[model samples]
Every structure is written in C-alpha cells, then in structure tokens.
Target: MSTSPTTLIAVPDSLDTGTPPAPAGRRWQPQATHWAALSIAGLLLSWWALTASGLIAPLFLPPPQAVLARFGELLAGSYMDATLPQHLLASLQRMLLALLAAVVVGIPLGIVIGVFPLARHLLDPVIEFYRPLPPLAYLPLIVIWFGIGEASKVLLIFLAILAPVLIATAHGVASVSPLRQQAALSLGASRWQLLRHVILPGALPEIITGVRIGLGAGWSTLVAAELIAATRGLGFMIQSAAQFLVTDVVVLGIIVIALVAFALELGLRRLQQRLTPWHGQPH
Candidate 1:
C-alpha cells in the first residue's frame, strides 16, 4: 500500500546471474527427413513421367501401377512355375548363410590387419588383386566346383563380403586415435588390454561402415550368384520373366531386393548402436 515514484522491491533467488539459455530460435534447423522424402518422391515421379511419355517402352519399363499389380500377385501366390514366396525364401537363405560365413572369417582377419602392420602388408597385394574382381567372374568355376548347388552361390557372396569386413576391421583398428593408445600405454596397460578395451571400441564405428559396404556387395553378389544354376530365387524369377518379356516380374523382383536391403541395413545399424555405443559422431 506504500507508493513511491515507480519504486520496486525484489527478492533474490539462489540461482546465479549467468548467460541466458540459448534462444530456442536458433537459425536454420534443416528438414532432413522431409528433404529425403521429397527426393524419393521426385525420383519416383521422374520414373513415372519417363515411362508415360513414350520415352521408354512399356516392355522394358513397366508403369508403376503395373509393377504394383505384379507385386500384389506375387504376394497372393499367383505366379508361374514357382510361387514368388518360394523364390524370395531361397534368395534370403542363400544371402544369410553367405553373410554368416563372411562375418566369422572377416572379423578375425580384420583384427589381424588392424593390429599387425606386417600382416596388412603381406595381405595387401592379395586383397588388391581380388577386391576388384566381380563375384560373377568365378561363376563358371563355381559351377564346376559346386555344380549350381547352394554351396557355390553361398561361396560367391562369402568372397565378396569377407574382404570388405576384414579391411574395414583393419581400417577401424588403425583409425583409433594415437593419443588414446598412448594414454593406455602410459597407464601401464598391455597391448592386448589396450586393443580389447580401447582400440576396438574406437574403431567399431568404421567397422560398421565396412559392414554396410560389405552388405551392399553381398546383396549384389546374391543376385549375380543366383543368376547361375539356381532354380528358385528373385534373380531366377527375373530371368524367367525375361524369357516371356514380363517386365512386371522383373520390376517386382527389384522392389523386393530394395526393400530387403533397406531392412537389413536398418537392422545392422541398430545392432551396431547396441554393440558399439562409443563408436560414432558425438551426441
């Protein structure tokens, strides 16, 4: 009830007078997900437009609707000679078994390459020689050796994936910060202890990067390998479709491959996150 000429009284809180929290209005947060969606939609629209404008023949490039119909039919168990599900199952199985073998072999080799300079030097020439060779290059020999059976197909994918994983492992180990290694050594840690605890964790991010590369290689090799003596696979389905000019089946196969590959990548990313929480861009 007391009045002065615009007088004020204040109570002090325990908090210190410090810099204000950053304005929530930080400039330019990107709409990354939206941009990605737009890009995908644009590609699809281009594909549709080109197919519609007579720039491409329907036989070679079916419309999206036609491809959708074919994919539906495949899901409904309506296909020739072999059901679509059976072909998909065959392809997935071969890819998985080969991927498993690659992991088992590649992880150890990667550890060796990463940990031992001499080992890397010794393997460099051999790796360089084979890395560029298409897994298909061995198709004829694989046919002779494994005779169009599952073994041959699995081996092809295995060869394609193993190198990437091993090299990646080596790359990861080598990429670990030198200061980190020095610190461990200064703390009287042994080499094994350093690798087990520090180097491996630090390198895991790159190792995952390598695995993703290998997965792509593995997917491509699967299709190539299945093109050989396999009776049932998405590649086989596409091959069979081409004989009758059924572009729809081919499109459907490609879509399935893309979807499966995307799913695998997502799963692998999640697994990497769980296993190597420390190995990535800082939060």
Candidate 2:
C-alpha cells in the first residue's frame, strides 16, 4: 500500500481527563481535634439558641451563662457540704482505687484463663454471667454484704471495671500467634520468658483497649456507687442537686463529670499511642 503522505498527529503531554488537584492553600483537611471542636461549638450554639429563644424552660435546660455562673459559685464555695474540688477528689480517689484493683486482679485472672483450660472452664461462665448485668442491679446486694460505706461504693465501681479488663486480657492473650509462641519456645525460652517477650507484647493492645472499656464502665457506675451514702463526689453533687431541682448545679455537675471523663480518655489514648505505635498499622 503506497501512502500518498502519512499524517502525524501530535498529542499534549498531559490530558485533562480528571479533576485538577486542589491548591495547597485550599486543600486543608479537618483533623480530629478540629472536628471535635466544631462539634462542641455546634452543640453549644444549639444550646444557646434553644435557651435564648425560650423554646425550653430554664428549669429543664438552664442557659450556658447560668451553668457557667454555677460553676464559678461551686469553685468559690461549697455545695452539698463540700467544695467542687473536694467532690472531684473524692470521686477520683474511688475511681483510682477501683481501677487499681481491677488491673491487679483482672489481668492475672485473664492470663490464667487464657493459658489454662481448667481456669477458663471455671471462671468464664461466672464472668459472662455477671458482665452484662447493670451495676444498679447488684448495688443493693453489695450494700447488704459490704454495708453502705466506702467499701460498697468502691466495690460497686470495681465490679463494673473488672469484667472488661478480664475479657480483653483473655482475648488478647488468646489472639497471640501460635507460630510466635512456638518460635519462642524453640529458642529454649522458659514459660515466663515466652510470656514476657512474645505474649505480653502481642497482647498489650487488647489489654489497653480493655482498660479503656473498663474505665468507661467504671464511670457509668460511679453515680450508682455514690448512691451508697456518699457524702462527697461529683455523682453525689448531681444527685443532691436533682433532689432539690437545682438545675444549674445539676448541669454543672454533669459538665464536670463529662469533662473529667474526656480528660481521662484523652490521657489513655496518648498512653496507647505511646505503648503500641504499631497497633493499627498494616503488616
């Protein structure tokens, strides 16, 4: 075939087949903190709007200014026979004590359950049976046996925290790879060495997760726990305020509790990132 003249077509180096890249200045992505702040701001604005528009009664939902004023009052003086700091301290002490106890007992029990079938058979049923029950359901029983003292209060929170830790530890331990365990054993590692070097490191993430869950449980149970004749606690303050319909004080107490819990959660998340940087990474 004799071509009179072959025509060559030139093509551009790049084609405009897809959307163009965004400019650096306009490409900003909202970080988790930004989203969180925005969400909080939105909620606060909604609250203010609702209150300012008089859509809700002040007794039901006090204005932000009233809550803030109540907070200042609490800081300057006492409410329900104790200052705000005193109530916070009392709550923190109980929470810390219960958390310490849960960590001490739950981790070892979980290890035993994970490593030994006999232990699992013996304890798993008991843990599963009670883990789902609300703290309030057992509060009266705890009071009856332990008395309506600090002991009962602490025990109530402790029980609420224990289950999650125990379950998480057991699950983490079980999830440790068999191959890794075998390799450790093949290197003439003792049981203790195998667990410390191979198992614990592998299981640390789950253990931390469990503790986080347990902390949430403990907080949820705090109000119920404080019901056991607590003279001082954020929960006690909330309860006392509710009884007298002190809406501002009640809101203030709730805000304080939520803020404290959020702070603790942030602390735990930092700890988790420090301890297990590889936890959520791809293999």
Candidate 3:
C-alpha cells in the first residue's frame, strides 16, 4: 500500500527554468557626445542671452554672432597684415615644430634617465627645477639668447613643452613591469630587444599622455610666445585686436584657439588609443 515507487525526474541543461539570462558582459552605455553638444549649446545660448539682455557689454564679451561675423571677415580679408588662414597656419607651424623637437629630444633623454640611475640623478635636479618655472618667467632669457625671431618663439614653445614629455617618458620607462623584462630576458632577448618589444609598448600610454599634456602647455603658451615681437599669428592677432578695441576679433581669436586645441587633443587621444589599444585592459 504504502508507496508506489517514487518517480525520479532529471533536468536537462538546456531547459529554461524561467530565470532571465545574465547580461552579456556589460551593456553598452550612452556616449558623451550628446552631453558635450548640449553643454556647448547651453553656453552659446547663455552668451547670446547675456549680450542680448544688455547685462554684459559687447566690448568685454561680444555675442557669438558678432564673433562669427568677424571670423568670416577675417577669413575673407586680412588682419594684422595676414589673413586668418595665414595666422592660423603660422601658429600651427610653431606649435608643431616645437612638439616635434620636444618629442625627438625628450623621449630619448627621459628613457636614458629612467634606465640609468646615474643619469637620472644627474639630470633630475635640473629638470625638476626648470619644470615648475612658468614660460613667461624665462621668456626674457630665451629671447636674449635666441633673439626676436622664429627661433625665440619656437624655442620658448619647445621649452614649455619639454618638461612634461621628459617626465612622462621617464616615468613610463621606470614603471615598466619587471616581470615582463624578466620573461623577455629568459627567452634570450637582448637589452635592445627587450626594450623594443616589452618596455616601449608598456610605456607608450604614459608617453602619449605626456605628449597630450605637453601639447596643451605649448598651445597655451603660444599667445605669450607670439607676443614677443610676432607680426603674424593668432596670438599677435588677438593682442593687436585688443589694443585697437576690436573685441569681436579678440573673441574670435580666443574661440579659434580653443577649437584648435580641442581638435589637436582629440586627434592625439585617438592616436594614443590606436597605438595602445590594450591600455587599461584586464589581463
């Protein structure tokens, strides 16, 4: 009587048990582009509102429209004996040249200092001392040495850029994983091979970061450098415009500088991601 044989049930692995599946990795999230656009739009609206309401004088902060009109005029004609394109190109050339020189000299020097304690000890003091000094603080000496020419402007920018790159490179090289070095050496890799394969790649992200920082510094210093007897540049254009009370041109110049710096930084960041895609990735 007691019991019919108890029935045994087996569950299949593929059978749905009514629970939802866990999300595949992480879900894709919203991007920052929309927010950036919104912020920019908001700023423009605020600027327009302020100027339209007569709360802010156009002399100090021109409406965006006025700056836009001035920008077009400059593009179509000339300012300070050079067109907008020429001024923009001149500034770009100086920044690029300075960046190139900084990269060429700084990366190698930083690597040396990072690799050799003796070298680091010898140069660290000098670098640290000069790194904290502002560009304007030493511009006079640079001008005296290089004179009021392209050399001075380029050199001023170069010096402004050098410290960040050098520090970043040295830090990157020094921060390389010792385990990677050991593994490479165990595989009969020479010092150069180890550096080429393991160290440089590992250090690339930091180096790129340094370059980005250096570019920003150099860009900010552009106006100051160009102020040193520059006849044609965005800095000079802005300065000259300000002297003549052409607030529209000054505002336009400032906006142009910001846009250009943003573009350069965006490009460099892309390059960094391309070169070091594995950066910050989990093992």
Clashing pairs in 3: none
**59 in model 2: Cα distance from truth in Å?**
0.5
Summarize candidate 2's per-residue lDDT along 1-283 as a digit string, tens digits: 2222223422232235555444334546678999989999999999999999998999999999999988888886999899899999999999999999999999999888888889999999999899999889988899899998898999999999999999999999988989999998999999999989999899999999999999999999999999999999999999999999999989988889889988998899999999999999974
Candidate 3 displacement at residue 44 in angstroms = 0.4
Better candidate number, 2 or 3, judged by TM-score? 2
Evaluate all candidate structures by whole-model CA lDDT and list the values in order. 0.82, 0.90, 0.90
Ranking by TM-score: 2, 3, 1
TM-score per prediction, in order, is 0.83, 0.90, 0.89
- Give the per-residue lDDT digits (tens) of candidate 3, residues 4-39: 222343324324675443344333455699888889
* lDDT tens digits by residue: candidate 1, 41-147: 99899989999898999998998988987777777575656778888898989888888888888887888988889999999889889899877787788888888
Candidate with better lDDT, 2 vs 3? 2
TM-score of 1: 0.83
Candidate 3 lands at a TM-score of: 0.89
lDDT, model 1: 0.82
Clashing pairs in 2: none
